[model samples]
Target: MPHDEAQARDTYACRLARSLHNQVSTLLGNRLAHLPGRTTPPKSVHTTQLKMALAETVFRKVYKLGLVPKIIAKLPVLSLMLAVISVCWLLILPMDGQFRHTYISENALMPGQVNLYFRETEWNHVRGFRDEAAKWDFESASRSNPQLEGWLSDFGLKVSHHHDPQTNLSTMYALMHAPRGDNTEAMVLVAPYFTSDGQKNVGAMALAPALARYFARMSIWSKNIIVVFPQNGHTALRRWVDAYHTTLDVTAGSLEAAIVMEYPSEIDNFSFMEIVYEGLNGQLPNLDLLNVATTIARHENMQVSVQGTAPQNLHKNDYWTRLEVLARGILKLAVTGVNGKLHGCEAFSGWQIQALTIKAVGTGGPDITQFGRIVDSSFRSVNNLLEKFHQSFFFYLLLSPTHFVSIGTYLPSAAVIALLFVVSSIYAIARGVSAADFVASIGSVLALFFGIEAICLVGAISLQHIAISGTESSGAFYVITAALMLFTVLSSVGIFAVKAPRFSRPTSFLLLAFALYFIAMLIVTLLIVHFALAFCIGISAFPLTLVQDLITKTHGNTLVSMKARVKVVLCLIASSPVTMIVLLGYILDGGKTEGVLGLVQGLLSSWHEMQSWTWFVVALGWLPAWISVVVVCAFGDFTSLEKEKTE
Candidate 1:
């Protein structure tokens, strides 16, 4: 109705009001500013200010990686990540690898040389020594072998001797200290016995004197040699070695290889001798160096046996041969158990010591001095080492005389089980999970751990008492039983009492671990004689979560608290994947191991002789797929739900 100017002014005012409304809405959530409907663009910063701000922002984010709530608090992504990690074991890997690694770099080897006539010629010296040793009437060598040290001292060795007659049941020890003021990088142990009257003794005590005489007279070795005359096997030998190690300046590297001669009647060092590399698990020595020695031995016409490869398989690289070795080596030797001293002490050399024994049972080969030179040469070869095999694989299994599968190739064995950890954690954080459910779930995990312990102990006992009675039959059984019972009782009581007192906590844990071992022994003992394997199976099946949770939670950590929840989810999901396999195992009723053990078995079955590349494929391929299933199933919609809640 007004003039045209009035109409224009009115329209302009309306626009101004709307602008003010937007500004207010943005500035004060739509209540304070007049420009409520407006969205103001941010003011530009100067170049200097912008750069400074960006740098500061980056620093802040990085600094908070360990401290911020979001790092551990980001549940959805973490849950998904964990889930994928748990299920990857279902994938398959190539089981057949060309027995040996063709990829091992060979530039550093001194591979082909033979002919140690010096060793073969030592037979005459050995015979005179053995016959004299047989004539002496023997007592516990521990009580009477001091003169042997004087004889060794004359041969240019610093002899430090020990005799623990009462404690060791008369076993003697003569430690030949590595000679100083020389490049003493090797040692040879002569196990010939002392001559005595038609001696009646336990495990042949007089044999040591003969060994002393045989080695002291040998002149074929260029390396420093320890011509030892121990009272008996392992016990006396370990003590002598221990004493020698202590007296010598251990900070300096000395003493290269050790050779123990067990043959009593042999008068000669024959052609090349057979090499026995004993034990499978942690006790096994480095193989590259070993292979090199074997090559040399064969070149010298000496045979190599893993352990008395009876009626020997000359073509040892066959699949079954390799599989049996890998399976038993990984599962049996890797397991923690009481062991014989020879294999046990061999572990000290970081898996490098080899034992060469020449027996008179149809095998005509290398004798004492021939064996000595080989020991000397082998050590000299090892001394040539510039490093501790850091670049090569640390864990591996030999499938054949020439074949090997590395730890990288075998990781699925562990990864499959490790995934279960993540699965269990995811389950704990699932929407409906509560403390009660957590405990119940955790209990099952505990049950599995206990069950596995029970099984392993029982299996070991059965293997001892039933399958094959080992060297120390009665003592091993009794020791094992006592150990299990003690371990269990301590673990239960200690773990349950996490809050007894600050100082007492560690005490409790120690007591508990011991108790767990004892409890294991008792359960194994009470188990029906025939059900030993079941006991072993049950113990292996048990989850480590109970112990993990106890330790992790007792420490009281935000990171661990979150991880605890994650462990629950993983344990839960582990059930589904584990279910079918368990049902199948029960149905089959044979060699039924569970949890980490099943995955271990699965991996062994699939990749007994897998190559390096095959291992890589299995780890990546299997780990991701299984982990993916865990993510989708357990972590479903968590991110979206969070975003919706935030919105």
Candidate 2:
């Protein structure tokens, strides 16, 4: 009975399986019959065909909905809007609650915890030294200064001088070994012989030695103190720093921090202290170091300023004041990064050493002794550190001395501006790809792109060589002239290249797209290391988005209208590298010809001496991009080229 029942169940299961198989086969056959070919596909090809059909259905639905192509078409307009929005976003960053209040992230940096003791005795010594230093010729007193070296030695320091054979400049430095700690780390006190503006730094020369004397009297220091008197300019100091890290005869220890004193004015008092913190290529010292100085100054009831913000306005902290301060900070950072003008402390950069300058502002306020106390307390706080400054913000935008916006808060603004170029690039690429001769157009465009870049690269190398060989005045002229000549050559190439019979409208579009994409990538990479520079360049180049290959069909014969000509002129005025440099020189240097020349010379010196990439980036990336835009605009209507061919 059981065997009969089992046989019945097995027969029912087999019947059900066959019924399901027949149903699936019938459905598949009907689906396949409706396919476009209407032929039985091999078993291996059947699944692929089904997947392709599904994808085609989805793509068709998406296309009918008009989403992607519509967005791509409007990308240029959207990009312009985004550029404006980016500026607005930056302005909004200074408002309350948008930025963070400055705080000491490292507990070891107890800035004002120590007692203040720098006083009248030290002030007397500083006065004496200042009077003596004022008598010496700072410019001619390079290789030997017996008076200054004698004073440093009197202060119980190991004094030595380093002379660079190439530049014929000299740097005299004195080291005070720490009595309480090991000689594995040291701090720097730099008193440049001349201010960044080429004025004598008499007060700083006196103050540095007097402070070293005071530091010698105290046994609380954990890091050895090195007093440096770099003659000629910041370059001398940079050379000294390089030698210290590499080949200096006298060794102290690894440099961990530096404080540059710039008391250019002869007066014993000042309005306020200006903290100069921008470093080479937009690098910054640890925020804790800046906060330490600020905190110590405030603790002593002295006014503090950053980025040249007036002391009176710093207390207001209103919307406009904050915005102005923010603008000044950004502009200063951009200028410092590009021009390589040293503000006394930027020389310590690129060596993993944190540094800044405290410059005495105006000629009336806190006595010089108070500034001494600020330095004294600051060094004392630094003495308390167990390790290097690692726990504070290194990348930040200062809204005020007491408030800041870090990278996470402010990077998006620059990123948004950079995105405009990317959007325009994408739109151009899409248009170019849809053309019938895409392969030929892309190949030619790439060749043109690389050709222009090659010219720029050669120009950059030539500029560097000129900078190295030429003097300050003549070097500036040579650099400017060389750059203009290169641009003219590039513009001529672009104009003539587009007029060739083989170069089509698609080629122009592709070339412009390639240039825009390169610029966007450059800005993106710069944002990581130099946010202010990236933002400045991105905003200045925003006009590139307006560039397009204007094509209009009129009757049978083709001609460029007045609008295209106007666009070319406008783009040259707004986006040309020459125009931008001239405007920046006028605005920042008060339109003085010498000031502009000095700026150019400074840029060259920075490139040659410190290996700053600003000149290279401008020469190679920015100039080429601008030339490509001009070329595309010069292309005009494609029908004109076709008519010429027929003729």
Candidate 3:
């Protein structure tokens, strides 16, 4: 080998070895600098720094992507998941070790700490009241119960009579002024002359006056007690409350709290009592009032129940029963917002005065005398309250007298369901459908909805046109049925009239979807603001969501297909006012004959009289969503829709 070639090869090899050493050193330095707990920077740390910066940038972009509309579109499923979780949470409320026993939130409410003095003497007075009440007819007794007035006056309290010429009803209230404080705030004890079901209030009407006399003698009262005797249950109470708050003819103060007692003549004794805390529009009294009432009743050894059922002590053995009771209570709470006569306390709720009703059902155990002691104890507890009720939960559901689910726990269920609709609506709007097309589509649906509702309302108002000279019950049933049939026929005709062209099909479907979402938003707002109402309507109206898909598959250009017709029938049957009536009748009347027909008749009458807008809201608010879905199904074309989208 040549000397010069050997020298060049050795030089190249040495240079390559030095370069490899430098590269290894750089890698090692970077690795060491990136090690945990190493504070010092390496000379060649740019690679690691560049990798970290890239990772951070990726993370930032990913976070930003989450806020986009496509991500927002996924919220409906998320809301559904949340709703399911919330419902599960509700069921857990009745589980073992899941809920805390209710306690007095107001330290001043020293409930059950005072001794009650009512005895056999109070019983004698109750008997006298019942005898006196039996002497008069409903009309005369309702107009002027002089015996009651005389008996109340004998107690040395100021008694006054209120007559509403417009209603042809009367109310009487006796005031027992406070000895310890001024008459700036007062508590009311309401005794309706007639039960909500039109039965005479034998026990409460008699006992309330005697109790008023008893309370008038007590010197420890800081707030004046007003004993009220309204001619009837709901309407009379509203009139009296309105007169009390508005008219200066009767001097009265702001109402702190109120208790309504309905002891029917048919029931001599009740084994247990249900505490009805839910009032009109789903308004709840301060949790403290319910706690105090239950505590006092239990102190008297009375079995306490909620929503017409006694709490079972099965200890994790009766999970489903408790859940059923809890569900029933929620349903009742939901319906309370419809301004039914289910609870007389609903009247006071409009005035922001906390109120509750204690309805004694099925006669068997606690007679008037024993019940008087419970009442006495409750009043004593209320007397102990130093300030207005403000400390306890204003939103809650009583699974039993002891266990409850608060707003924080149960609100998420309805909220999530409501949000699901909202997400569906936003997605509807995002489908490139024009606002004009959406509005026109909705207008057609609204026209049908409003037209049906108007017809129903007009028929209800002009029931006299049905000249069926038969029995009142049969006549009402026939007339209402005929009216309902007419409405269905008219609504069906209107649905057929709103037939959209192929181009308008997608727009109509999206419009209906958005309207549903808007309704869901309203429902969510209702759930947040008025939970019972929202839950009641939201749960029942859930079937409306299925109509769109059902119709889309069953119809094309016309609802002539049997499948489409069946879907339409199902939608109407499931979401109609009749369904609401049946559900309400089942809950309120246990599905008795008089209950179902009576509920329907009352709803019609109330709607006519403008006393309740619940039926209107149901017919108008829900029908639009329902009809729009039907319209989409009858007229939409999926193939054309997809083609347009691609173009």
Winner on TM-score (1 vs 3): 3
lDDT of 1: 0.38
Total colliding residue pairs, candidate 3:
2
Candidate number achieving the greatest TM-score relative to the actual structure: 2
How much is 248 displaced in model 3, in angstroms? 4.6
Error (Å) of candidate 2 at residue 386 is 1.6
By TM-score, how accurate is candidate 1? 0.49
Model 3: per-residue Cα lDDT over 5-42, one tens digit each: 23333343344344544565576567765677757755
List the RMSD of every prediction in angstroms. Answer: 17.1, 12.1, 13.4
Please report how far candidate 2 places residue 579 from its true position, in Å.
Answer: 2.0
Model 2: clashing residue pairs?
A: none
Question: Candidate 2 lDDT (Cα, whole model)?
Answer: 0.76
Clashes of each: 113, 0, 2
Best-to-worst order by lDDT is 2, 3, 1
Estimate the TM-score of every prediction: 0.49, 0.86, 0.77
